[model samples]
Target: MDWSTTIATQVAQIPRSGIRAFFDLVTGRSDIISLGVGEPDFVTPWNIREAAIYSLERGHTTYTSNYGLESLRRKIVTYVENFFGVSYNPLNEVLVTVGVSEAIDLALRALLNPGDEVLYHEPCYVSYAPSVSMAYGVAVPIATKKSDLFALDPAALEAAITPRTKVLMLNFPTNPTGAVAPVETLEAIARLCIKHDLVVLSDEIYSELRYDDVRHTSIASLPGMRERTLLLHGFSKAFAMTGFRLGYACGPEPLVSAMMKVHQYSMLCAPITSQEAAIEALENGTPAMLEMRESYRMRRNYLVKRLNDMGLDCHLPGGAFYVFPDVSRFSLSSKEFAERLLMEAKVAAVPGDAFGASGEGFLRCCYATAFELIREACDAMERFVDKLQKEAR
Candidate 1:
């Protein structure tokens, strides 16, 4: 008769995101310049928006097939093949999900047996560990140090694996930490997984956001890894289409088929309008994407420089739109530091501990904010750090 027990104990065990709690606090507080959210500040490209508009005008309002429209899946196949070198069978190897988040859930739910061990690198996207837990999987987080440039440690990763280990979850150009796995690193992981019979779930939503001369490598593209890797990517981060609720997965056919059984029960399919828009996005968004990525690189460079110059030890953001900086010198807990940054500093950033325990004593500042806002926020942080130092003295 108790409402609390009726709620799953697993759900209670999972902590609400530390990032979101403060995000709610800062909402509608115009006095603060927010760098708390990882979402891009860019609008979805006009052509992609128009594609959705056209789809709706043409009466594509109902849901598509449970596996999704074949046409869109084919486009995704071509996109992945051309860009990431991951070949997928459009007919049976791709499943459309609401977003990369949902695609991640599908992979875990479909593949994970109870108590299966799932490994992911940290500081990672906030959702990965909890998502595994929901599927009755054990989340084994392997922390990557700032010294390693937040790269996944193959030795540590291999050492963490046990007989119970079933899934290796990967997020590249990662949320909050912006670490990209180079090709050579991914091949080593591929060899490790091949030796271990581990299933790979790669969250590659930020694949298009690489900066400088760095190329984003997909673990799935490596020779042996493709068969075992369930690739999760979407239009959200790359095309600034987070609100569209569109994503896709490509993997071995049997797994994709297994996912649709769950998918059919879970979401059926994404909106037809959104699918049509995403098709166009996958097909045509590249040119604009390069421009947008260049803009993000510029922002990343500026934000990293500003933070370090202000005495916060920010690492270079290789990709994505986040900069995780050490705030340990302030002697404030990450959440308290974030709160102080928002209050006295009149600026906002997410506490690094929000992502994982490995993230303490740091904060994840999203460089997705506008250049103008970034410049002003940097100026504000300078004064804020100056005051904090003076107080300590």
Candidate 2:
């Protein structure tokens, strides 16, 4: 009768996502101004939604190929090459999965043996280490510091490499910190990966949301990287299609084929309607994406400035929708700071430790909320911070 005995060991050992766990306290609370979840505030563009509706009207409701609809695959590859400057054959080198989450699982499961190690930067998305663990791989973290703008350190990555290391997982324009990898740093990491012969899982879902004219250079696009890198992207972020849950993986034929094998037996295929909608998103969703990007840029500017003015020590993140501000000065743990902020200010921002231990002294404030709401949250936060400082005094 003990559920603990029946649960898989790996699943039992893996803790629930810290981000979701913290947000659970805010559930059903309509009064909170939330900067917790990373989803875009904008609705999916009407044309893209219309595409899904049109596809449904045409009765395109059946299961697609295990590799996904050929049209969608072609569109995915074209988008990747055009935007990321990394080309792949659409026929055998692209696999449309349920989302970037599924693609991460597929790649890790396909490549990892028991105890194989995955080297990833910390203060990253909550899913990276858990996905590696679920695949029976050892999750090795390379700590990225605020001084480095949270970019993955190539030297740190080199030190983490061992005989057991098999994959390097990267999420640039990263989660929590909004750190974008520099091209030179990426080139150095790419060199190390080449020397070590490690497969790179480049998760560039936030690649399109970059700010301040910060260019996103994919590790996959660097010399000697395309053959060994799996590029993961989707419509969830830029196109505001989170509910559709559509994403794809692009890489060498053999790697994509291997991921497809696992995906076929598991997910089978991404939803047909989502795939059709994704096709539209890739083909004609640019102007809307740009507008949303600009809005986020404005929000990011306002939020970061407010945090710094309130003495939170936040660096201007170059990409993504989140700002990680150092809260060590408040003399409270990240969790305590965030919990008090929610309860007292009715403002919800994620504790940075929700991402990883390296995030212990910080809080992640998402800028994807409406600008007006973000302004209100800032006002509340300023008052909350002033109260905390007075208590210390």
Please report the candidate that would top lDDT against the real structure: 2
lDDT of 1 by residue, 1-393 (tens): 987789898898888887778788888888989988888899999999999999988888887899889999999999999988878889999998999888888888999999999999989889989999999999999999999889998999999999999999999988879888877788889999999999999988898888888898888878888889998899988899989989999999989999999999989898898899998898889888888888988888988888888899988978888999999998789988888888888998888898999999889988888999999999999998998999999
Worst 10 residues of 1 by lDDT: 13-22
lDDT of 1: 0.90
What global local distance difference test value does model 2 have? 0.94
1-393: candidate 2 lDDT, tens digit per residue: 899899999999999999899999999999999999999999999999999999999999999999999998888878888899988888999999898999999999999999999999999899999999999999998999999999988889999999999999999889989999989999999999999999999999999999878989999999999999999998899999999998889999988889988988888888999999998998999999999999999999999999999999999999999999999997899999999999999999999888889999999999999999999999999999999999999
CA lDDT scores, all candidates in order: 0.90, 0.94
In each prediction, how many residue pairs overlap at the backbone (N, C-alpha, C within less than 3 A)?
A: 0, 0
TM per prediction: 0.98, 0.99
Error of 2 at 46 (Å): 0.3
